[model samples]
Target chain A: MTSTATSGTTSPEPRGPRSPGRPRSERAEKAIIEATLELLGEHGYAALAIEAIAAKAGVGKTTIYRRWPNKEELVLDALAATSVPLGELPGTSLRDDLIACVEYVRRSRGSRSTRLFPLMMLEGLNNPRLRERYETVVLEPRREVLRGVLRRGIEAGELPPDFDVDLGVALIVGPILYLTKVWNVPDDQLPDDVAARIVDSVLDGIRARR
Target chain B: MTSTATSGTTSPEPRGPRSPGRPRSERAEKAIIEATLELLGEHGYAALAIEAIAAKAGVGKTTIYRRWPNKEELVLDALAATSVPLGELPGTSLRDDLIACVEYVRRSRGSRSTRLFPLMMLEGLNNPRLRERYETVVLEPRREVLRGVLRRGIEAGELPPDFDVDLGVALIVGPILYLTKVWNVPDDQLPDDVAARIVDSVLDGIRARR
Candidate 1:
């Protein structure tokens, strides 16, 4: 479905660059997205309204509606602007790759990741459109990146022969999600050995017998 | 300021028992509390209105307001009904306690605990009044139940010497919260060994280096 030819030929989203003009005022766009995130942090996702965002951005609600259809869609666009692109990592071990993943979460969301993310999560629970956008755009993209590194590990005989790469990925990172988002103690709240503690359990079976 | 004492010294409220008349209907009180939980489960704390609950229960809103002042207070009462009373285990090892804990989660919230509980957690996140009520009514009660077992385990040398009991609780239950509230996966979708995996990790550690 994604395969397409550029320009004159049929393309779903036009793979090649379009002939552009000034490109929608990058500074204004950035400011609007930043305002949306800040509001999500302070007021939470449910309380957020487009009228409030437009007011905070010093733009009209019409301007926001002109750009994005509704609050969830606007949140999608705003989130897209701020999230890490989940691209490549080093050819190093799985440890390094996982480190990069946690580091990405830290850098992208900053200290507020633990605080603001639950709002998005809880909102996703309530809103179908937001949930779709969250799963597709926000979550899958990151999962895909980690899956690539795991796939490489499988071929190289680094991971166990029957290791479920996907579950392994989840196992490695799942603690971070649970600790930060649920408990609110956060990964950052732990002593320095927390990451190492996590790595231990995932690699070795936790059974005292094992 | 919970000293609205009736005959009991521990009266946290003027919920003064058995007003000297036709003995306030036990049937009415049970039906009201049940209706409140049902509404809370169906429509969450914010959407739950006193008028609606009273109408549903075939009682006056004054009856409800007489028992509880506001939605927040009523929700707290409703939460108390839903939360499992703790210290029901066989008094064995930490594993037994944990298994009991997981079982308690199931009994308290049913198999769908994760989905239903998010409403409470998210509301607590946003509402400070709810936070105090939450800790007083739910979190602390449960923790206190487990605390005795953990102390016994420490004496008997089951859990590690340095184990953080509160953090341990969070870690053990954290993934359930993540999968339910953040990942929005159905509770029946829980991986089979999930509880075991978390328990093992806690009793041991996750780190390969450690």
Candidate 2:
């Protein structure tokens, strides 16, 4: 079955710029990722099988192996694709940038990928390899983006020079995550002004000054 | 096997007030709960079985069924036992109470039951029954504790009378959870003063007083 698909990739089809169709390899990769995510959501990390993913993707095991060396890498790529990119942060004030970051989290609450996140983390408790890859590939990159914004805030004198960047990132992202992930609050119930409210509250503090 | 265990319970043993030994039913109940927790940590909620738990506890399925109607209830009771009780809060100031709450979370980070929390929540995502039971039994009770603290603060004018109790709870608990649960930060690296710092920061705010 693998050989059949491998042969198909190398078939003597017309190879020219005029061919409007997408490259077969790219198509196959997309299918593999889509199938991996679908299977992951349905069965979770422990029960997912490579053969099942390959069969569901209508590709060959050889094709999958040729692209990704293992299931973890495949799962990583699929998850990475689903993470909502922070995109270009507006070179505005720290409040705006922080609000943007919280907004990103709020938007992510509605995605299918966000739903699978807890499951992946749950599996990570028992599977160290997957956890490490997820941290480096998915978590670290997102955290770095937020960290950069905080660093800029310090540079611009928007935040105190002695600010704790790591805690700051956690403060900005944590409440929203707790709401969406742990509480599993529905999108409708989550206030539209929550991002602004969190940013303002974290900035001004919650105490009632005398 | 169940019949034997059930019969053992009703055997013509002398009901003497002078009996020094613990009651037979109480001993069986304790063993059953212990076995349930052990299995939950090892196999997760999905794979846990009543028969396996009974066998491991040296009790019969009948004995378990007589105490708890189903696995969810049994699991809830087992989990409730493991949760660290927040006994007798220091009724000094809101800062102290909030810090104590955060400290409770920090201390809980080290327990075996805390490790199983994510796995149970992950399973809860797919199992509505489990999710509902967990919300009512575990999460809601804890949240109520925090909310009560926030409510008292509001009433005392430490916070504005219109303070959002729910969001306040999220802000206080969110960052530490992000560190322990999401980032999987090690206990050794978690600073001793973190609870105080988080509580103080949330109360004082993070923005530079420009």
Best by TM-score: 2
Q: What TM-score does each of the candidates earn?
A: 0.70, 0.86
lDDT per residue for candidate 2 within A66-176, as digits (tens), equals 656677777887888777777887767888998999999888876767777877777887898889888888788899989999899889877778777888887889999
Per residue, candidate 2 scores C-alpha lDDT tens digits across B1-210 of 122223233333543232337588778878998999999977878789999999999988877876676788888877877888878789899999999998888788867667777777778777977888787877888899999998998888787776778888888999899888888888778777888877877777633222
Best by DockQ: 2
Which pairs of residues collide in model 1?
A200-B206, A200-B207, A200-B208, A201-B206, A201-B207
- Tens-place lDDT per residue, model 1, B73-187, is 6666666655556546877677878767755653444422334456666576668678666667656676667676677777877666776666555555654544444555555
Q: Write the per-residue lDDT of candidate 1 for residues A48-138, one digit (tens) a residue.
A: 8877888888876655554455676667666655665555775688767766675554345434433455556556656777787777756
Give the top-scoring candidate (lDDT).
2
The per-model DockQ list reads 0.31, 0.44
In candidate 1 chain B, where is summed lDDT lowest over 10 consecutive residues? Answer: B1-10
* lDDT of candidates 1 onward, in order: 0.60, 0.79
Clashes of 2: 0
Q: Where does model 1 sit among the CAPRI classes?
A: acceptable
